[model samples]
Target: MATKDADKKDTVLATAKERFEYALSRESENLERMKEDIRFAASSPDDPWQWDEATRKERKNNRPMLTINKLPQHIRQVTNDIRQNRPSIKYRPADDKADVETAEILMGLARHIEAHSDADVAYDTAADHQVTSGLGYIRVIADYISDESFDQDIYIKRVKNPFRVHMDPDIIDPAGSDAKWCFIDEDLKEDEFKAQYPDADPIDWQYASDAEWYPGDKQVRVVEYFEIVEKKTTLCLWANGETSFKDEERPESVMAVEKPLKERSVMKCECRWRKLNGQQILEGGDDGKVFPSRFIPVARVVGNEYEVDGKNYISGIVRNAKDSQRMYNIAQTAIVERVMQAPKSPWVAPAEAIEGYEKVWQTANTANHSFLPFNHKDEAGEPIPAPNRTAPATVETGLAQIAASASDDIKAETGQYDASLGQKSNETSGKAIMARQREGDNATYHYVDNLGRAVRHIGRIILDMIPAIYDTKRVARILGEDGEAANAILDPDHPEAFTEVRDENNEIKRIFNPNIGLYDVYTTTGPSYSTRRVEATEAMTAIAQGNPEMWQVAGDLMVKSMDWPGAEELAKRMRLMLPPQIQAEISKDEGGQPEQPQIPPEMQQRMMQVAEQMETMGNELQETKSDLQKAQQKAWQEEGKRIKAEIDADKANALLAIEKAQDSAAAANPAAGQGDVQEMVNQAVAMALANLMQQREPEPMPEPEPPMEMPQPEQPPMDGGMPMPESEVPQ
Candidate 1:
């Protein structure tokens, strides 16, 4: 098995090297042409105009030559504009549908990319255009680095391209198309080359036997080529179980037999090698360095170039300014050369009469003002008048006209006029100035548009790698709309991932699961995106000032757009400053509204008065109860005494009646009436006892006395010293 694998690896490496050579051959002339363009755009310091040594020597005797470099300035200006308004990554719903989870993932990845790669990308982008030859390439690489704090080791690198990169000229789709794209770096050091292929055989350095290592000597060239290759991709039950199953320690719950699968084409990397810097000799290796990526890490940023003759690439702003700059330089040289030949002072002398000519010339040359003592006599002693040549006025006029024309041409070609540079110009009003600047900006919008497209491409690459980056369940810090950070679990493994959130109704609000569908990535651009946030905030503030109801909402928006430290925290504190009633309204749930806590001072005072009145009534009720009990007790005692008196009166009446009855019985019959009298006496006694019992009957309970009313305080007498009425007194 080991021998078979080794043989396969050899075949792969052989194929990779062959493809690398093929790509180089196809793009060799193009690369050379690009280099020439770069040389013209950014001239070397040693030779600014790139003239040969002999040409330079000849030019020194002719006219003054000055290389006015405007290329760097133009490149800097465009780059600065981009830096000022750098694009940020935002996740949009696929098919313009809103997906919060997708958005969160995109945001997290965007923040990561911006934090790690923005600086390098910006620098490389500027350098690419400034070089005026090669298209900038930002390589996005993902690896597991042990030292990373978040355990996320996706890298965006600005690789130094040793050769102009090439993609299939016919293919437009960078990843999906069947284009063979390759990134080449030549003359790599022996150690660097070995690092990539550590398991392979050591390189036999050609000049290592008798000498120490020298730069660019005994070097190896490395090429990483990406092409579409067909392979058998199995989608059987067993394959799914092996890949999609989350747990490795346990067997899959569902089992099925492995089966044959259809063959499919996929984009893969084929790393190739050549010894001694693209020499005919090939290095032996176990297969090429390929990775599981749909696209090559290298990204292309094609500049704004018109394809006139099927050549898409062209020089940037530097190319536009080149002609005018050269013209300006030559004009300046002419002026200087003219000045050099012009005389400061003029003199004339009769040849026959001239004496001590050398001495006179010396005096004129040495002194600022001098009188030469020479005889004004010829062989015939005749006088001759000396004349001064007027300074050529045309020299200054020619210089001025040519300089102005060159400046105007440069402004027209590059769209870098006075207004764009913030210089005061012939435009009278600020509006006019702004209009002019906008016109100039519009002219160069293509470059900006290209950059935007490149940025979008980068975003697309990040989106493509999302599944792999978030392959496992891991906690990622997501930035909220308020710019506050919150931890969220990115689980690409589960269907119900990111479901731990709820809406105002307390119902589950799950962001879309990334494992399902694709998310469309779009870049926010133009003035609408750039300044709309500020405008919205301002509008919100203006509305809130009078209405006051929208203060918290507007403040939050302002804080979001405001580019300052602790903006979110500041917004939170400001929200806390809102009136309790307003805060309650803002924090209310869908079905449950929070009660307002604030109360008016007048209403509070009334409530206090009502509470005091209730307390007074309670005290009065207790007193009245005690008095009623006392009155009833007194009435009960009086009634008991009255009953006892009545009983005594009844006893006396009964005794008198009995005595009368006994006397009547004695008068009727002396002897016979004696028994009758005794009997009558007995009956009278019984009747008296009955009467006493009747008199001693229990009396009814007495009614309680009415409670005493509280006395009203007295009031001062009105007008006539009369006492005040109870109705008039204050309670």
Candidate 2:
């Protein structure tokens, strides 16, 4: 027996060592992940991979998370348990009740698998990059010094803001497009360019000022941005809005070339500087002759004449000064840079418009994780009134785009666009606060806010670089154990796709709508777009619960995308491309590190008071569970006593009586005594003979829904028991 006990102890030690090694491996994986995270934060000061601000905004505005997932929540809870320290070891075979040991082993295997990740696919890209050259349109500001003209106080202003991007005809939009990627890494404004044709109805034109024809001594300003190469260039202009208000019969704009007399030179400006005197103030202004700058002349100009309103008109050309700091706030490119999501031109809607459609079409936003839904659009532009505009379609499957511009098209938020149509201010409209277009025909520019960014206070990119932050391998490993983890009996083969549910069905309601989605446009497929949307929304909800943190982080990155311009929103977007639930679990697991206790004086005092009592007793009783289980197993095996021996002796005494009954039964009912009939009766009688067999009776079951209360009167007496006045009684 002593030798056997020694052998058992050795076996237990070996098992403990194995478990310790597994836990150590998990810790190592965790450390590696932490390193990766730090690394990611570093290289991408704002966005890793240099994704432009436009691209970031466009992607965030497009890709939303399917929040409302439970996987992430579970990971958070369990990881927190591990971090608290002293968690229960997964299994102790017979020591556990039921199959808990097996369940825990399966969990361990799952954790082990999650400790690493393997997602290779990427999605949600913005437009691709293209070269950009500035253009110029002139704004003629006439000071009424002579008052002799019929235009005194009547400023006959002519603006020349319609300049073509002039792309080499060869550098086409994956299609025939002049527009470049307004947003990061996306295609340019081809749609808007298409909308510019005279017959095209998708016109994004706005009349600059008031009036129809500059009648008399009107001044003309032409601002054009061109590379001005030897090669021929195309001059692009708006069709509807750029026309001179003074002349209603004329075209809005026309393309022209440099005249032989006018000299073309590269426009230049002195660096911005201020006037300063001996006391940082000059009598009139600071003046430098030999080494001068502030007052130096910047541009060269040529005078010219042009045809408009059916006749030629005189105009002054701005050789330069339009591209100065004085004009930085108003350039269309600058305008797009300031605004969150950039559109190639004022005529066409932005990528945000397309993205908004998908968010609603895909997500089941139970937790309001707009995390996956369409981001609101900016709505600052003067929208074309209806009858002039086509409406967004609707679907019964709850898939369709909202009419609400992120700025103020409330038809979306109010759920009125699906009907004949109703609208109001949509507060969620980001479009309203858009970075105004600086150079459409009558274009104006406005200030755009740049989101703040720190300048790498923590300099080491490698120091902060971390691997995939969240995954569930640690928990999986804790669950299963075998020479190979999956072979451990508890590992389930299929995990991510959960068709059957552990809880009640959380089905989203489908409302009636007149429009459909991309699914509807398909020529051949399983279900209509409407049906697909319903399914997608349901899946999104389930997946969301698995990782709300990823959803939230995705939203944050979106704001930054809107703020940053190029390659800024990349790192955050890459993080979003991961499976949501796994990411959440990873975050929770890493975040669950036990904080050093900063116990308050009051709490510390109480702990010290009880230290000699409760704590001391606990320490004294720190025996391991293995010692107890072994002792119990030994005791059970030793006490193998048998009750069957006494019962067997008693049965021998009753055998003679049983034989007598069997013989009588045969004599009493001779007709009933078929072959072996007496034997059957004897067998049953012998079985029920409790005194001889020592058998116990079965317990009775409880009745269902047994009545417990007595009945009560149907009605009670009135408040004063007033039987005196029937009129006063309540009916």
Best by TM-score: 1
TM per candidate:
0.66, 0.16
What tens digits encode model 1's per-residue C-alpha lDDT throughout 337-364?
A: 6776665445555554345566565566
Mark the regions of model 2 whose C-alpha exceeds 4 Å error after superposition.
Answer: 1-311, 317-624, 634-640, 653-731
For model 2, residues 408-434, the per-residue Cα lDDT tens digits are: 222221112211121233333444323
- Per model, state how many residue pairs clash: 0, 109
Could you tell me the lDDT of residue 169 within candidate 1? 54
How much lDDT does candidate 1 score? Answer: 0.58
Per-residue lDDT for 684 in model 1? 72
User: Residue 494 in model 2: shift from native, Å?
Assistant: 33
